[model samples]
Target: MRTFEVPTRDQVSPEAQAIFDNLKKQVGMVPNLYATIGQSANALSSFLAFQGAQAKGTFNAKEREAVYLAVSQINGCDYCQAAHTALGKMNGFTEEETISLRKGESDNARLDAIVKLAQDITENRGRASEETVEAFFAQGFDNAALIDLIALVADKTLANYVHNLTQIAIDFPVAQPIEEPALV
Candidate 1:
């Protein structure tokens, strides 16, 4: 089997090295997945810029984290699941709440709508169920919010696909595996 090693500051391009320095300064450590992305000449910088722009969209930090959790879970991206689980907690979700979001459910009605919509979008490949879309709007999300949510899905999916393809080591606390139901 092939192995993907996380690139170090010294091994990456100067632009990526500079980004690594900034990430180390800002996030304390450059995550393995992000460092892996740094192996590419432009992906690290482009991803950061995309993420930064998405951060300014309609969803708040917590809401965005919820979307990430749901999308990551649906996509079965363990790296993203672990990373977003930690990020969800940082944005104020309790451990249980994060797990629930990963399962595509939430106690809060509005949040439930958001998480469900994220999961639906991911599972259906952009063709979210009309019912889920209706519920999202019923929770007071406008068209702008819908557009932002789609963008968030796209953003998270990019990272998820990268981690899925590379199988990099996770730098965050590992997320617990969700159990599957036994056959009847």
Candidate 2:
């Protein structure tokens, strides 16, 4: 397996260097995934634009983190699972709650809806069941939030796939194993 090189700021184009500078300021350092993305000058900036736009959407931090956790776990991306696990904690999820969310279950009704929807979409390859959609809305998510959810799915899917393909070093606290609940 060929390992993807995580480019340093000097190795990328000037445009990507600027983005790396901004990321360093924003996140304290450019994460390995983002650094790998800087290998494509245009892609890094475009991804930043898309990601920044989504941050302005209706989903709160916790909700957005749930989407990331569910999608990443379903995709089996270790990098993202680790990254979002840390982020999930910062967004107020307990370590146990983070593990539950990663497994597509949540004790909170609203969060369960979000996790199930995200998991269904990822597991089913972008086609969540109608029941999941209805439950998501019944849980008080509007059409805009639905759109945001889809956007988040797209975003996290891209990140998950990137890490899956690159097999990058995990940059955050390691996530625990995802325990599947026993089927009754």
Top-lDDT structure, candidate number: 1
Q: Count the backbone clashes (under 3 Å) in each candidate.
A: 0, 0
Per-candidate TM-score against the hidden true structure: 0.95, 0.95
Report the error of model 2 at residue 168, Å. Answer: 1.5
Writing each residue's lDDT as its tens digit, candidate 2 over 32-83 gives 9999888898988888898889999978889899889998988888899899
Off by over 4 Å in 2: 181-184
- Candidate 1 collision pairs: none
- Model 2, residue 29: distance off in Å is 0.4
For model 1 the TM-score comes to: 0.95
Q: Residue by residue across 1-184, what tens digits does model 1's lDDT show?
A: 6878888899998989999999999989999989998998599899999899988999999999999988988888999989999998898988889888888888999999998988888888899889999999998889999999999999999999989988998989998787751110
For candidate 2, which ten residues in a row score worst on lDDT?
A: 175-184
